[model samples]
Target: MANIIKKIKRKHKKKKLQAERAKMEQSRQNRTPEDAYQERLSKHRSAVIRRAVMTVVAVAAVATLFFFYMEKRSYHNYKILSASEQEDVVATNYAEMSGKILRYSPDGASLVSDTMDTYWSTLYEMQNPVADVRDDRAVIADQDGTLLEMFDKDGETGSVTTSYNIIKARVSSSGMVAAILDGGDATWINFYGSDGTLIAENQTHLADPGYPLDVAVSDSGDIMMVAYQFVDGSETTSYVAFYNFGDVGQSEDDRIVSGYTYDGVVIPQIMYLDGNRSAAIRDDGFTLYKGSQIPKEVETIKVDKEIVSTFYDDNIIGLVFKNGDKDKPYTMRGYSTDGSLKFEKKFNIPYTTIKASGGNILLYNSSQISVMNSRGVEKYSGTVDGTISDFIKTGWNRYLLVLDNGVDVIKLS
Candidate 1:
């Protein structure tokens, strides 16, 4: 018959392509509740994008393995976890309120606890005592004696008695006072008011706007910074003044708005930088001043050598040099109040006392203790016990060592 009609016309075209692939798999199993919820929301968005790319690559591989194990960890030793109770901190002077422990001397001043307890012990006579805390307020003065005592970690909030003869007194975290009076050849700066009120007075002169040498107050008790030192004819001038008792500097005269002059360097140190800048510390370099109300100057770094030691806090401004490299005999340089440069580091630690606070960099010496952390790493080299005088970080690597045999509270292991 024609070969059986060519095998039934090739089996009727293979049963019409298996009946159109079973009607396209029955229209894909008849799905249509919005296509089975858009195929289960596209397989639940591909399993939540594969668990968010495996949880962002496992939290960036555990933050790059905890930043290379805190940049190659280092902490030699230390473990006095607590030991406050033996008394007699010798010439007693520690300072670091807000983390407790103030302990002054020229007769009295106290605010302790970091295991040492005793949060208030006022009694002043201070012939040469000196302190200046800032954030939780603290100002135990009396350099040449005219009295001053203000505390605030909960106790003794005010007391001042001036009439000239307190060549230095600065406190402002709300217990305002900015004294520097000793008007013998005219040089009174007075600005008190923590309850001995006298808000403003200026009578400086070494032949016009000079001799203030160092005075800084600005923790929002409303601006002030002076660093004079004058002697023009044989050269040796220094300047830096800015006073603004808030009100945008009441029409500008004694509330002087801005200033800057440095014919021969000598800026003795002027600070107020925790953000809205104001620093001056010079003798070759350091001058930042950026407004919160007429601050201006901005930047001035010069330094070449001979810094010896400076250490600050308001978030760093260190500076210590003398590294003729006798095995890294010291060269710590760190800056940030606008002059940039954050770390140079090269320590050997013979430090007599250095501190930078919070970002670390505490090189001590009353029995050695070197730490480093403004990203120069070197977190602790250890050796501590007694005579430490003050290391007070209080938490992280823990420390409150102010000793002469008293409060230990360490933990740098």
Candidate 2:
């Protein structure tokens, strides 16, 4: 009976071990092949996504580096041209008609070529010489208007003697000269042709439109715009009158084609942008006029800031004012002939002289010069060797720099 009991126990133990082995096999078989494949596929996708993300990051880093490299390459400093010299040039002018430069001294005026060669020189007696240079011609006159000399790139064209003492004079591109003369009780505006012939003359009396503050003549010397100021009681009135001297204006009374009156505004400066367009700059703002014979007011722009300086070219007007900032000394605002504000920018450097040429604004002092385009982008800023007294644009990126020592032709690239 003991042997039988021991055999049963052995058999039961073997059966229990076999059942455990079978259960282990079944569990292993229940893990599906598809499930294992899905797990491996998910791991592969994650690896691919990680690699793509890393590639994108690498590309972005490279692109940023390239952008900075290109930006650094684009920026350039000014280069001094091979041509430089020291001269005793008192005044300088560029003639666009003949593509030459004229340097004036106490002795006379010398016309120079682009190669710095003197083409011609003329001697004359000039005291306090004021020169008006245009694309076509140049006119040099003394403060007293005693001697008026008109010349071009070739040589002297004509000379005229003023009847009254000259307050100011301007020359047009067409060689026409306009002079404002002091006539004691009244002011006289005289127009001279390129041949020194008197084209037209007018006198502004105090009893009429008061005193003539400014005068501008057309390129053809056929149209004239005058700004007059008069005080009525406690209020001051300003008038911008257009006079036509052509055949169309001969029938009109006083040859006065049109006139505009402004109360409490002083129009101190008047200019002719072209043969048809005129501008009157007042203490507050400016007014633009358009017409051939009869000028009509088309636009008016009012400025609120304190005007420090103003400049204009044939197509644009620039006003520089203080914006109450310590870092920035002045703000330059540009306007088109149609009264559109084209650009505005702040200048960090102080400038003694400001001018508008072509489509750019130039600001310079004794040691430094800066140029800003029409879009208000600073194209160039650099230190000059000596004190710059005057400068003229000889080429697109070149300038005829007149210094205290002499004149230099420089290139700004």
Top TM-score: which candidate number?
Answer: 2
Clashing pairs in 1: none
**Candidate 2 runs further than 4 Å off:** 1-76, 82-86, 90-98
Give candidate 1's total backbone clashes.
Answer: 0
| Residue range with the least summed lDDT across 10 consecutive positions in model 2 | 89-98
State every prediction's TM-score relative to the real structure.
0.32, 0.77
Clash totals for all candidate models: 0, 1
